[model samples]
Target: MIASYDALSEARKALDTPLFAGLPGDVAVSFEFFPPKSDAMMLQLWDVVQALAPLAPEFVSVTYGAGGTTRDRTHGTVARIISEARLPAAAHLTCVDATKAEVNAVAEAYWEAGVRHIVALRGDMGEPGAPFVPHPEGYQNAADLVAGLKAIAPFDISVAAYPEMHPDSASPEADIDNLKRKLDAGASRAISQFFFEPETFFRFRDRLAAAGIDAPVLPGILPVSNFAQTRKFAAACGAAIPAWMEGLFAGLDTHPAARQLVAATVAAEFCRRLYAGGVRNFHFYTLNRAELSYAICHLLGVRPKAAAAIQEKAA
Candidate 1:
């Protein structure tokens, strides 16, 4: 049949051609950044935004710190991104160590500052390994926070999804149920925690479909530049780092440039696999560095908007 023949042709191209050759650059991407604590860091983050802006991300998000520690800094960073960079910026707001009134006030301030998108979360505690204890008068969880935000304004909201499972989740089913509750309460989409394996996301997406949850869930991609630090993050978030990846980064500690090249190759291949599987949207956790993310995007055929326009016009 024609369908079977087309499938065979695609497989042949995959095996015969260069992995990154002839990609159409049809994917949509967004980036996440953290608030800077120092003046120098602020400059660095601004440079990063400038570098990645030409790709025309769907939105750039600034992260909220643990227990609302960086509230003012987060607001300032997001405001600058919107006013200065002219990018659609989403501010993270968490239900942690703050009353409902307090959280609502922050949301109102964001609305007044021209921010219409928020990433809602039930944030981690200040202390490591300590269980999250909601404030006595605060929203109980992310679901409650999402509903409260909806009541305050018609903001576009995104909540977190765990592909493996949350460390505190009792079971995978409970995690999915929690995600459902958040979506039902009015979140527009869920951005998953960073995962290394493409199959991890595929299985999670299948499970989401089975649960009858049809919300768009963007896969979070963290191009690993520091293997040792990534291991710590993986341990905290319950994401597994494959054994093969470990061997790739082994003995590259002294070779920073080569390490970045390896990192790009590994992450681009992982993304190409996801793209072949029909994923069109990706979210990158930039960690305030643009090179790794930019290179990966380039390999995936995402060029600057102006460049793409020129190509189209020439054609």
Candidate 2:
């Protein structure tokens, strides 16, 4: 499970977290979920929602699949979270393969449903390895999408940021300029793409500050449930997987249970370092699983109301 016997011991030591002085409520968090295409996945998603509901994240977001492929399903999921669960939910809106009229209509529907937030994006084409092209009649990019959403309503908008620079960007500075444009157009905050090193995010954050853009850019944390899958995701998103990570996950392909502990330990340490660096808000890529995320949050000093009862019993 661990790289070596002493490696396990050292990892546990490295994870001696600085217990949060702030209450869980003081540390704001939000979770991102993708809409389920199958009946079984739908049931499983609700289970995850129920499990994390007690954590009281700032808001939960359901991702819109490429080219608005999951349009109806995304709406259904967001509506249920708002109505059935009585949680504030944000729906992802993408400007790909849809006219501006259609996209604005969807935004109106969300407003009608009492959803007040939107994560605007220039989503990819539905096909694998396909390039993204703007619909002739649709918003041109995320910045344009943010402005369009603002025109419809003053929705609290969140847009994506690339800590390592977007794959399409000509340069990192250009990428930051694009991010500033989105925020200036009306996005309230930017959720960064996931990165392994805290330094990567810190550097990006510094660049944003130096650019004179004043907005919160929350760090996105992905608790790696599967290393192989995560590596591929990272590669696609242009995130670097440092050599150290492979050594940690090495030989654990057949050890799912052990992988959970290692994942928790790595993510908890990641959070601890971020928190120590003065980053307060985090957005987790939950991947429709609760156990790993819940564990990492608990280790970062987040506790549900029910955890208090358990603590009382222990006392």
Candidate 3:
């Protein structure tokens, strides 16, 4: 009877109070983007950076393509973000087909370009579903890659985490152990792969605590504006999509604007739940577009830096 009463009271409070009101914007956010391939795409990405710049993200990251295919483009993009946008930028580095000397050269170049952060990974093979074969002379895994980066320079490193168990892992425990190895090696934090339900992250957080790992793990938030495409990718990465989400997006193919609204609402609620569960940092997979991420950040009480400052002053 007590549990029932408490549930009812909580439901009533949710109904009476606006969901996003009084949030105080005490959260740190980071965004991830892929390197642009062409001149036109470069311009589009610049606009995206401009749009989200006012929010003053903790840092922005550019992804390294599979097999280190986009090395040059990634460097160019990260350098531009640092020199032009004046934002702290992190370059993604991988141990795939690159020898130790080659990888170190890239890291040295980034250090010369004023980049002080890196997202290190044991990237996938060039072809999907193919087993990852480390180069004959390259670092064996992400842990080794992290150590190598530290040996070269003091890069603030962030490694990937798989809340849903990475597709390549033998089991959940093994996955957590691998994450521990990375953190133990030299990574400062882990940025989790995107998952739909808030409980997914909550459960992973519990597991991490139980495993005696306490480093900050930023929840990766992917707002699903393109449900079908997201579903396909999620399947590849071992992320589960809730059935209710399919029902929510079920006939919105022709309704782009409405789909975006639904996407923002879902992602914002997910972030809000994480916040209630003691999550104070969020990492967004921006997919090179700013609208959905921008909207969700706004709902979470994150505003332009200047506006947020003024509001705090008034209060």
- Any runs in candidate 1 off by more than 4 Å, and if so which? 1-12, 307-315
How does model 3 fare in lDDT?
A: 0.90
Candidate 3 or 1, higher lDDT: 1
The clash count for each model shown is 0, 0, 0
Residue 121, model 1: Cα distance from true site in angstroms: 0.5
Candidate with maximal lDDT: 1
lDDT per residue (tens digit) for residues 1-315 in model 1: 975686566657767899889988999899999999999999999999999988888899999998789999999999998887777899999999999999999999999998999999999987768899999999999999999999999999999999999999999999999999999999999999999999999999999999999999999999998999999889888899999999999999899999999999999989988876668899999999999999889988899887454333212
Residue 114 shift from truth in candidate 3, angstroms: 0.6
lDDT tens string, model 3, 1-315? 975686565456545788777778899889999999999999999999989888888889999988789999999999998887888889999999999999999999999999999999999986768898899999999999999999999999999999999999999999999999999999999999999998999899999999999999999999897988999889888899998999999999999999999998889889977776667899999999999999889988898887454334212
- Give the best candidate by TM-score: 1
Which residue pairs in candidate 2 have backbone atoms (N, alpha carbon, C) closer than 3 angstroms, thus clashing? Answer: none
Question: Which digits, one per residue and each the tens of the lDDT, describe model 2 over residues 58-97?
Answer: 7889999887889999999999988776667899999999
What TM-score does candidate 2 reach?
0.89
Q: List the residue pairs that clash in candidate 3.
A: none
Give the candidates in order of TM-score, highest first. Answer: 1, 3, 2
CA RMSD of all predictions:
3.5, 7.1, 4.2
Local distance difference test scores for all models: 0.92, 0.86, 0.90
